[model samples]
Target: MATKEFKLPDVGEGVAEGELVNWLVSPGDTVTEDQPVAEVETDKALVEVPSPYDGTVKELLAEEGEMVPVGDVIITFEVGEEAPEGGSEEAEAGTEAEAEAESESEAAPAEESAESAESAESAESAAPAPGSGRVFAPPSARRLARELGVDIGAVQGSGQSGRITEADVREHAESGGGEASESAGPKDVEVGTRPSATTKRGEESASAAAGGAEEGGAAPSGVEAAGRDRTLAAPATRRVAEEEGVDVDDVPTDELREGEAFVDEAQVRQYADAVKRAKAAEAEAATEAEPSGAEPSAAESGAESGAAAESGAEPETIPYRGVRRTIGEQMQQSKYTAPHVTHHDTATIDDLVETRTELKERAAERDVKLTYLPFVLKAVVAALKEHRHLNSELREDDDEIVLKSEYNVGIAVATDAGLMVPVVDDVDQKGLLEIAAEVNDLASRARDRSLSREEMQGGTFTVTNFGAVGGEYATPIINYPETAILGLGAIEKRPAVKEVDDGGFMDDDGPSEQVVPAHTLPLSLSIDHRVVDGADAARFTNRVIELLENPQLLLLE
Candidate 1:
């Protein structure tokens, strides 16, 4: 039977790795295409990774509860064989062949490497090294060569498929490999410094010589190495190791060839998890061993604990994991990435409250629960139309401001797990009732942990009503990528001066103003200062207030 390996796939945008929550299948079990084989938790949400092949499971490469990077082989499958799949006898034969091939491919024979070294030196002539024309190398290798004052384009590649490895560049530099004329007065390439035009052409010519074929695109057997000790791993493996702050060499592996370990993301993840668990165990032991005051009876201790809890002397500890960790990371990123400026204002929303009261029965007739959120959503969308900058994202990398034509507002919902912002798409196209229904549905699902990842994504802007829980105003962090967030405070009745039309119930005898109760709504607007100024923020707030105060204008929308 031919065996195939399955690698973890990227489940979300920019997700480099995920925690393997559980495995749905076991060894020798048959699984078909599109069948979920594993559940993974990324920074956003829980994702199920489905199988891509129809075959019998041969082995699970990764342990559960480990964080596996994208493109790491998590499992292996055996298929197209009638022989019984159980026991090591059959598995041993299959794995042995696989291991042998892996060893040979990773480390070449010493004699062959020496021969390759000699061939590389001999190939260097007045023109250039034969394989040096198109030296495929990583940016780090190029940077190293430049720092060492070596001509990268003149060095022969000694990596798999003729890709110029970093070791190859260093070796070429030590051997003083370069044109005699250029080597006499070589220039150092500093970091972030641009290379000369002639050097740029040389680098381009070297790449062009291979007809622009992708690096490592050629057959592995076609290339030769020169006794270079390099780690054999995919890019994803290296990326994960870097992200976890672990050296790839430190990761232990049983698949050894020539005393060299072939490291992948799974090995790195296992090492990282072991380190974390060790730290946690050490901390727990320390806490337990610490002596307390004279031990009390069980009843007394319980009463003491209860008193401590009631007096707020002891605080409850909550482990930050899963959704809580996700929220923390996102909040940290947003707070640090954006320079936030907050504008606070309050509007007399007596008109809005009256209009909502008027529409309550009409909305109930259609079996819809209408609230102030729909009016707020519609007003926000209308205001966004007038002030587009608040409804846009700053793409600093592309040096462009993205103004969204469609309104997709995210409503932040507080839940037991954490805060979740579910986006309501095409808000401008939906009526008040439709928007209210969607908001209710999204919030309900969010609280119950039934909201999908997609439902929480693609928000052009965000609206957080902290008023529901009794907050007047807050400086909410910009919800990343998006430039702004609007916070609605609690609505309350306050005394205000009003002009008397008939002068019938005024304290003054004739033509007087009166202090009367009016509904007031407080608003807090926070925006990214890099893309928006104070003036723009004020104008946006004004527009939203205008739309709410003049609820009749919403009919035209």
Candidate 2:
């Protein structure tokens, strides 16, 4: 076998590098060709990198959270005689002679190891006993296990091909599946945990620092030790213990399930409470012992308050990287680079609302979610056609403002990880129903972090809906390179001046103006003032409002 170095390939859009988010395979794990070996976070998405060789993972060269450039070796694989693509031929030169020498050496031990090999093979074929073997689970499932503080390896897989799923992790956590035995000296799994680490398929370390227990072999340092070789606790549980100044390895628990102990959130909380109470009591006793009538010295009181405040207010450090970091960099670039101006207006849509109500049933029948967004999108596209500058880019290098001919619209989606803008390509060429369906799919996939590179890029204009989360308006920054963006506010019934015939009693000039409640949609359109003028922004916004008010104009598109 020869060792081969696997380089990071361009995920998409000619990306130069990627942030190594997680390693799907570890050293010594067997993998097949095209199997995902690591997850790389590009500028746009978190993508899984597949293996090019079928072999055993010899080493993982890149660390998680490290930024690796394209064509840089991230991992090594030991494969068959003719090493897989990109394998080192020089490394295989010594293999033939080495194999013969090894063959001569192994012949003597072959007979002696026959029985052991047979037993090992049989054990491999059967279901592995809990608390013992390598876990086969997806990365998402592992992450779930870490959050829930369950021992993934000990939990039985209920997925196809004996793989583990998020549901299995949750079930294992709830059922208190398995834990360390008390007889085992400070087992890796914590007491009270139902089962444990799978990961960023990242998992938590099982073993706690081992030491002498009490004389009676009870847990040491006021905490119940794990029964197994590793302590099992969720990352969240460990964090709580750290904040509370409690050691997770020493957390005491009375609950045991299936002859095992795994630490959980409840156990951590209980331990934290006890530690707090104990400190409070100690403080109170110290106060009482000070004096019967004497007050604490000002210096002493100040010191106590200062220490408590310092500890309580210690800020948690969150490493800003990956998608969130990318978003920050883009936002900063756009804000600092572009001169922005915003125009705010409202569209009264009573007729438009009725039209939507009438067509909603028809839309539902076709399994489409008819949202105000679809109508808004058509309106925006129509407006863009009239005002081409709004749907354009400022090419500073060329010293020109280039107006794009394509009508690709980017919809800003707020994901749990960060902000993502999934673009809808050729919006002018598609129907309203097609746009609606595509928007729904893009939004769903954006949240799931499953959108493709093509789906995330190539937007000429952008739209953001703050109304979904309840906001009136915002000065949205342009999706840099793009000239402008539109923000939508919640639709609310507001008093508006309307022309009504009051039997022409007031005057013969015209119908009298009356104040009436009408459903009004607020809009905020922001543009790059370097290229787009304030008047241009107002004109584009007014065009959108006009289409939205008529809504019939949207159907004509």
Task: Kindly list the per-residue Cα lDDT of model 1 for residues 404-488, writing each as its tens digit.
Answer: 9989999998754569899999999999999978888677556534455678889999998887665777999989989999998
Off by over 4 Å in 2: 12-16, 78-310, 500-511
TM-score (C-alpha, index-matched) for candidate 2: 0.61
Best by lDDT: 2
lDDT against the true structure, each candidate: 0.64, 0.65
Q: Candidate 2 on 421-450: residue-level lDDT in tens?
A: 999999899987898888887776565565
**What is residue 324's positional error in candidate 1, in angstroms?**
3.6
Deviation in Å, model 2, residue 269 alpha carbon: 14
Which run of 10 residues does model 1 get worst, by summed lDDT?
A: 105-114
The per-candidate count of clashes, in order, stands at 0, 34
